[model samples]
Target: MNEIILKFSKESPQVKDTPIEISVIDVQPDYLYKFNAGIDGIWTTIQDFSEENFCIWKPKIDGKYTLMIQGKKKDGKKSFDAAAKADYIIGAVEEDIIQSVNIDRRELLQGEKLSVMVETTVKPVMYKYWISGKDGWELIRDYNSENEFLFTANEPGKHEILVECKTIESKNNFDDFRTISFIVSEIEKVQITDFKCLSTELLTDKELIFQVDARHEDSRMVLYKFVKIDNKGKALCIQDYSSKRMISFTEREPGSYKLLCMAKDMYSTEDFDDRAIIVYDIKPYKPIVIKSFTTDFTSPQTTGTKILLKAMVEGGRNLLYRYMIEGKHGEDSGFIRNNSFLWETKYPGEYKLSLYVKDESYSGDYEECTSLEYLVEEKLFKPVKIRDVALSKDKNYVKNKPINITVSADGGNELRYSFIVYKDKEEVEKINFGIANWVNFTPEQSGEYELEIRVRDKYSHKDYDSHTFIFFNVRDYIPGIIDYILIPSKEYYMVEDDIEIEVITQNAKETLLKYCISINGHPVESTEYSKVKKFKFTPKVSGKYNLEIYSKNIQCKEGYDEKKETKIYIHEALPVTNTKIKSSLVKAKRNEEVTFVVNSEGGKDVCYEFYLMEEENWKLVQRYSKKNYYTFIPFISGTYRLLALSRSFYKKVSYEDYDIFKLEVN
Candidate 1:
């Protein structure tokens, strides 16, 4: 026969040695009494085992409970009662629920704290808890209801947490176990930055101060390390540094220096990793000088001034040195000296001065430098003198018009000459002829004329001492007319007439004049005297008449010239004795043809006479005779007389003066 027991717990497996307890209860009367290896067969009769110990049942699954058995011995003995079946009703129980197993954090830092928790539920009751690992858990707090267990991790790694449950209270059998595993981890790490320097990259007798950075979450100190790196990447740690942040070195020889730096956290308490770097070299530097430079100072009058010079020096530093002088008196004072120097002079004759320079430091390897110089000059200008002078036309005294002044210089071309002419103390003419002697002038008014001429010599180079002056004048003249008269004089008989009279004065200076001729208060055309100063006229009829002349003076240059008036008597011709007739013969058709003709001898105031043989009276042709000749054609045969007679102006001449001619018929 077998026995069964149940128990519970909520602590880790290490705190308590076991989790359950087992004991016998009651057994059924039946045939199953087989017992082996501490697990027993089904119990049947309580009375049959009441004298012996009962067996335990280890519960591993869920199901309804009953029992049946056949009685058997460890040996081959058997009985029929042990084979009978037994049935009993037992209460069902569940395994404790292991709800969760987990770490408090997924990630962890260096040595920070971490935790693990186990959560569970009892199916029908509470359970015992335990964890399996190298180091046991540190229990923090506990909520005991057979449901949860929490603990802190002492170290880092995987651990197995477990729980077990049973129906008995003792520390053995009929129990169940459930488990889960978890993990933990370790911490973080450190580095450095390269060094920086500000001095010239190629060093020549120079030193440097530098800086670098350390990289870690914590603060730290760095060490400076300097080394000389060869052509390869291998590193060597150098120790003679002045500071972790800065250092200086004196350059002795020329080569390259390699460098490094390192840092560590103060908390790390150890030296930092070697990682920073810097590199460079060293050589020589210097400069040079110049000495003793000079110029000249004396000379002659026209030549102006002079200059003089001298000097000494150094080499490789200057390589090739030069010297120069300029400004006032410099034209005569310039010169050049290379390498070394000596005394020198110039004759440019100047008053202002200056100097110039060049050397080897400025010119590269193979070339030399060139130098230049300058200076200013000075001078004085002079004037001239004039002696004898003359003119072309001479007057009784100084004239009111232009004249010539001829100047003569004893020094000739050596003189610079100038001239001026004055009238009544006022300047009228002036001229400059450079260095020449003769010049001319014209003045406007009559006065005491004064002429001045000046002359200068070239050798003195100045007008302040060697110049001369001279003086003279011109006279005025007025001209005149010699002969005079009116033109065309004698009057005989009838032809038209004109007369012009003029005055013949020696000097008649005048603008416009007027003239007239008159007879007894009426106008006529003649001059009263043959020498009248002026006159004019024309005649239309012939007669004896009185003649007169008059003139008005407009303007005359001579203040005393005169106006004019005069008279005379004139005679002209009557045409009577000078008369003659011209005739033309005509042939009519023969009914007794007849004609008459006459030419008149008379002035404009005249009429013609006509006498017919048949008429007792003489008929006059009132308008015909002024033509000098007349003609008549008679219708019947008869004799006629054609006569011309004089009319007005009879008192001035003879009235018996007439002309007659006859006419005949066949």
Candidate 2:
């Protein structure tokens, strides 16, 4: 069993109809209790508590309330009871209602004072004032009987002024609050003036200075920020927190720009002023005069030759060069972005070449020009004069006898000679000499022979001279002949390859003879033979073959005949095995070096030739005698192919190998 005790907050004092607290102590840990408070002795349950010992009670009517508690112990074996009495006086409730809220100014500048007041219907025991802004609500004043508040507006924008009234007489409901809105604007206004650059038009690589005047009416220190803006409204640079009124900057390039000056008070950033000044014609340095104009060749140059005109300049950036050619008939002019000009003379005349250089950075306003005169001479058409024509041997001719005719000419850079031999007015043989003065011929047929020699200057078509000689008596003697042969042009051939055979007789020019040719005992039927004979033969298989030639009736003799024999060998051609590149990619970047290698099998000492494909033709790039690889560096971007030709040392036939590569520069 446990004992219970009861307690009252106001044991013997009289209080108004306010809230009071009652408690029970020294009870069992797990006991149940019932509490009652009323004027009547009849117990009306107010609370049933199992573990709590205290409670708050508000009396509605004036009465001597009986505070009682009844409880049982945890064992349910014993019961207990306790009682106390308290007096409460009923009074009139206070109605806490706000009548009005007012402010002296709705809008004011920062650092200015604002007055706020609040009025309530019932008298409040205390008043609280709060100011709410971006930083949230803050209590300004909390005191008894204070209905008004005054404070400085420190921050800008809308602010809330809240006032709370409280009366302790109204138990649990005695607070009245109201809020009013006001605005605080910035106090200082800054003005920017005298915004100017010292020089709007400046030369390149020169400094530019800008100045501005700024002030504020509130007598606060002014701050400045300068920005250089380009024509596209993009800020090139910004100088922040500048204390000085002037700024200096240098630009190496020339362009259009603007200087923006912004001024603000040091105390506030909310108010500021800005002004812009346009700067123009930032130009390059002045153009230098053309010091000299000269040509590569001397005056009186021959027609159809190129002459180079060069102009020397001292100082100018991005210069535009203009060249003018003033001839006797008309004038030709053009512009180039370089300093050199090439001129080719088409006609013989005197002309003036003028060079004008202007600075493109200044819109071609500054220029320097100079001119020079020169002449072009025409090529002369001089006829070739033949001093004499003579024969190596005497004019009387014999059969199978060799004779040489020589001519002397005076004219032109180059002279051409032609020889014609006629037997009884029928022209039999003609020979042309290029840059040579003599020709050799053998009189095979004995007759009255007329030989004519003609000479001409290479530059003239109709200016020529000739001489004629007549041989009166002709006779026949014992004839002797010599034979020379050339096979495959270099004495080498391949299987299935076309072979050309040429035969030359040393002492006979016009004697016709009958001949029989054979290859490996296979008879080749050819009836006639000339002084120099050529024929083609294609070998079908690979082997060694003996070629034989037999000629009869030498120099029209009755029983004079000769026989000759030669041997030729033909072999199979080797194929190009592979073409490789050392680089990782066949496509490369411009200006990159690439290496190409070629390989061949079954060839002794291969010769390699590299070619570049240009405009549908393969141009020979280089030839390697005994090497197999080549290195190439491309300067431009385009599609390119490398052709590698592998050929043997003695054969004209080659095996072609190629690979394609691409370059990208941009």
Q: Report model 2's TM-score to 2 decimal places.
A: 0.26
Which residue ranges in model 1 land beyond 4 Å of their true spot? 1-191, 200-203, 229-243, 254-257, 262-274, 281-283, 286-666
Model 2 local distance difference test score:
0.64
Instruction: Give a tens-digit lDDT track for model 2, residues 65-112.
Output: 445567765556645533333323233324447788899989987767
Q: With candidate 2 superimposed using the best TM-score fit, by how many Å does residue 80's alpha carbon deviate from the native?
A: 66
Measured on C-alpha atoms, candidate 1 has an lDDT of 0.41
Q: lDDT values of the candidates?
A: 0.41, 0.64
Tell me the spans in candidate 2 whose CA falls farther than 4 Å from its real position.
1-188, 199-206, 215-219, 250-254, 269-271, 277-281, 284-315, 318-353, 358-666
What is the lDDT, from 0 to 100, of the residue 625 in candidate 2?
Answer: 70
TM-score of each: 0.20, 0.26
140-219: candidate 1 lDDT, tens digit per residue: 33223344544454345665554444533523332444555655453223465556765554444555545665555542
